[model samples]
Target: MADPDTLAPPRPRRWKRLRGGLSIQSKLLLMLLSVSLVSAVIVGAIGFTNGRQALQDSALDQLISIRELRAAEITETIDSVIRDASLQSRNLSAQTLSQTMNAAFDELQSDPLSEEQLETLETYYAEVFIPPLEESSETEYSDTAFIPDSNAGQRLQLGYTSRNLDLDEDYQELLAREDLGDGTAYSAAAAQYGDYLTHLVEEAGYEDALLLNLDGDVVYSAYKGPDLGTNVNTGPYRDTLFAQAYRDVTATNSVDAVEITDFEAWIPSLNHPTMWVVSPVGDDDGITGVMAFQLSLHRINNVMTGGEQWAEQGLGETGEVYLVGRDDLMRSNSRLLIEHPDTYAERAADGGTSPSIASRIAEIGGAVLLQPVTTRAISEAQAGRAGTMTGLDYLGGDSVIAYAPLHIEGLDWVINARIDTAEAFAPVVEFTRNVLLSLLGILLGVSLLSLVLAQAFTRPIHRLVGAVRQVAAGDLNVQVPGGARDEFGDLGNAFNDMASSLRVKQELIEEQQKENEKLLHTLMPESVANRYKKGDETISEAHENVSVVFAELLGFDDYARGLTAEQETSQLNTLMRGIDEAAAKAGVEKVRTLHGGYLASSGLVIPRVDNVRRSVEFARQAVEVLDRFNAQNGTSITLRAGIDTGTVTSGLVARTSLAYDLWGDAVNLAYRVRSVSGQPGIYVSQTVRDRTQEMVDYVEAGTVETQGQTETVWKVV
Candidate 1:
């Protein structure tokens, strides 16, 4: 107290010395320049970041829209094809055709083809069918005659040429052939229906149409080639897609059902990729035969590539839509390959694709059917996910992909619309470049002007800088002096408001983080939840000696069908809550609940010494709960549960839906065991029974067929 000046804090002497060396005007000039430079830099950075993100979002939205449109068109096309096939099947289901087809089936089943008939069929194949294909391969058509100059016509011509089987001559020869006739009813019907089928193909835009009997014998073909009278079941085409489709349609015995085969290399079409759509032909009695139509790839290509709507739909130079089968093979030709084969080939080679695949791309002249795709988008879409992603495409370049599953019957296909990322983001990149250049020019001019205005605005700005430094160091309570009523003083007041807002926002952020953690814990195990909270992309672990339980509510489907929507939801919730309580009491984790089924696990999330015993106890308690519910509600609901103990892998699935699930043969066997239990009660696999035999009582449930094997199960008593 005696020396008040010395007692006061040392006064940050170095800062004072530095401040004292500069005039107020010079200090103000530096502060203004620094602020101007930082603002420009920050604004430029924000503009670049926000602009790029907005562009990406817009691009993805457009891609999704295009993908949905293309998917709809494709579905419509498929539905139209199926409808036409159904109509044809109904038309061909006349009593006359049915009786003839049945008679043909009887003749084929009762007796093998005679040597003369077999020899004649072979000669027809060699002379009539094989010559046109060989001739097409050896001889080139006149450019004016077959190669159309128009782009659309050229695409059609390319598809026609790619088929490599000019069957017009074979068709005419077959039509003219009136040689010794086979006395079968099939032959008579074929001769009569041939002209009608030909007209149907011409009118309906079908490449060809065929009528086949139950024995897989082609009774008639519109083109009347080697396939007519050829037995698809035992002939050279026995293993073909058409043969498989025929077998499927015949096996179903559904008159209105149709089977569409996946695109495959059809040897009859000179190894060109081909697709067949087949429908059953029947008249009241049962399915007597099948009607099959060969689809043209050109039409599919046109729809997929946006033949007429490409520009109108805003699909830029690099945008395209295509289809991929479950096998990850292209179902339609690739736009890139069609328009720029050399570039596509070069990119494919540069991406380290197999030489065979690259050579095939070139060989087809950019037609991509049957070409395998290994992109992430196709893989995810095949796995039943619909979304957008940035990844490599079929041509091996970076692309933005939007894909969705195509839910056509008897086919697992995904529709993907994609564009090269560089092209898609070109506007954003150019805008960013231009913005940065303009920002530099503005910053230079502002720096010079800031030096001229420094003297008039130095004191409050210095105070503002000090306050900003304090705030940057995590002290948001600091406030700059604002006695002056000018721009500088207004800035000080604005900074004070921002600091207060930041403090409140920080508090809210911490509270939200705690709430998020709590919510995540309810969704998954605490340890896994914590990892996910810590930003782990994949949270999966393998546990040894774990027990899994699969419980299905028998007759729930029928019971639910009779309940109102509210009643159904309430009843399901009550049942699930009861099951959850039972599992929790037994120290087992309820992993997930599916329709009429619940999956739980023990010793995975929290290891226990008697996991199998716990799982068995959980199942028994669940059955008791259901029994009580049924008694109280006057319902006949019953629980069927299967328990198995083994190693299991568990993890969170899907970023959006976010489900914690378990996967292993043990889990699969548990489900199978439950399904085969037949009568509802607690059913434990042999593994579970063996592990918890001493702790739980069980009676042998006999050997139940499960997953292609016989396994002894036990009912918990």
Candidate 2:
């Protein structure tokens, strides 16, 4: 160690020393590199986040658009079918068909048919009616004959039984057969009317059409099938959708109102899904019968599948639009399953679908009338919620789905448009990857550029730092080099200009200090002004013994009203100036002046022993000054002065207005005394009279009432 009195300079840490030893160029380069890296990362992250959100929103919009388009198509198709069925139900030809059958049934029920008529009717049923039924039922024929289990199968079985084509002879005999006498005329009318209905069905693209009586008996069929003469209400097919729909339509109060039934499998028509639009038909009576039109599922599928090329309608790959009933079962065929059954099945299996759903997929090979959709989108839509969401699809895959309820009558179904999330967000992923790579490249290039810039700026920056240090040490005369005409040179010029401006401003500031001091003294007492100028917020002092003088011009208001505004202002100013001079001469501080009143105080700012005497003298002088003013201005504006001596507080009232004011009982009493009527001279309070009895002349003025108190006042003359 060296001598005990000598101390060595403390050494910095290794890292601190290293940092201190680094050149300006190295430090600047490091700082720029860090900032650039952080900025690049921040910008890239923000861009990626925004881009992803934008893409997701776009996908949701597209899904909603697709859902709306498909829903409109379905709604239009249903409306068209209903209108056609309604028109046909009310047609004259359909009425004729019903009447012809009704007349033939009435004839057979009222009277027995002759042998010749029975033979003719049998021949007609065999040749004209039985042939078509047999032809339409060709699909039901199989070498291995079997009993049917489905509603469609039961309907076929019931038709065969009613026709006596497949049932036992005893059962056929038990069924009452209608005997139409003189069948030649009835057969011709029936054939012509049946042909007309067949034409209507063919032209309308309907699978079949039937006319039923109020008893739910199919009296006429366009295809002349075995369904004829079968009572739907009590027949073997009573539980079918058609029978249920007929009962519903006939039960309605309005016969003109059309009713549609939900889609269900119709067995007589090849076990295919079918929907019916039924309208009640009536003559002069009420609803006597109902006409049912079978809507072909093929036509409906064509409308719902977007005319066979749904992909062209904005439903991208792995995207489809389908309908779901309130029961969570699919109402329409799924495009994916219809187009790629094997792949759909495999995906369904891999997705761990329910056993019932998987079995239905395997059996039906598609979603039509089979697949159950229990996804959140369908559930919410059926529950009356209409929006888009990201959730698990029917196949357990992540999907973005948009769903809405279809406003179709007699059908509680929701339409959903969906796509795989992976496909929908593919662009977002690719964009994010590209942005990150670009940011990395940009950061790399920025680091190299920052090094070059740091080196270029170091020389100028070192000169600037040295100049700043000198200026900070009060060496404003130091000049920075500005040889190169770049930003650095401009900065040097600005620094020199600023230094010169500061030196000149310093000189002006000193000169302004004296002027401010003079202005402050005029606004307040000397001590209060000094305290305020020294940055004291409140400049208030209490004086134990002080005198307050309040002087008001009597008859000033009446005199001001008679004079012009400018003349009145001039006269008031003259009177105030006189009062101010009088107060100054009497060694009292002029506290404040109002429109017609003036206040002065003594001993508050600078304590004095004869403060009461001084205040009384000031009041007397102010009254004399007003008297002189009245004489010079050719007016009679006398002065009413009040003087009081007591302990009072005085201070600057406000900083902006610079109103110096005196407060306390002495000031209040002085103000009240000055406002006394019938007294023109100076009035002195008891306290003032007591303090200045020897110095001032006072005459007893009878007790005056002021502020609810009676006080004996003395007039100074």
Best by lDDT: 1
Off by over 4 Å in 1: 1-24, 92-191, 252-254, 285-287, 308-312, 366-369, 437-452, 459-717
lDDT of 2 by residue, 493-558 (tens): 678878888778877897899888888887887888878777777878888888888887788998
Best by TM-score: 1
- lDDT of every model, 2 decimals: 0.75, 0.72
Screening candidate 1 with a backbone cut-off below 3 angstroms (N, C-alpha, C), the clashing residue pairs are none
Error of 1 at 699 (Å): 32
Prediction RMSDs, each to the true structure: 18.2, 28.5
For model 2, what is the error of residue 269's alpha carbon versus the real structure, in angstroms, after optimal superposition? Answer: 3.2
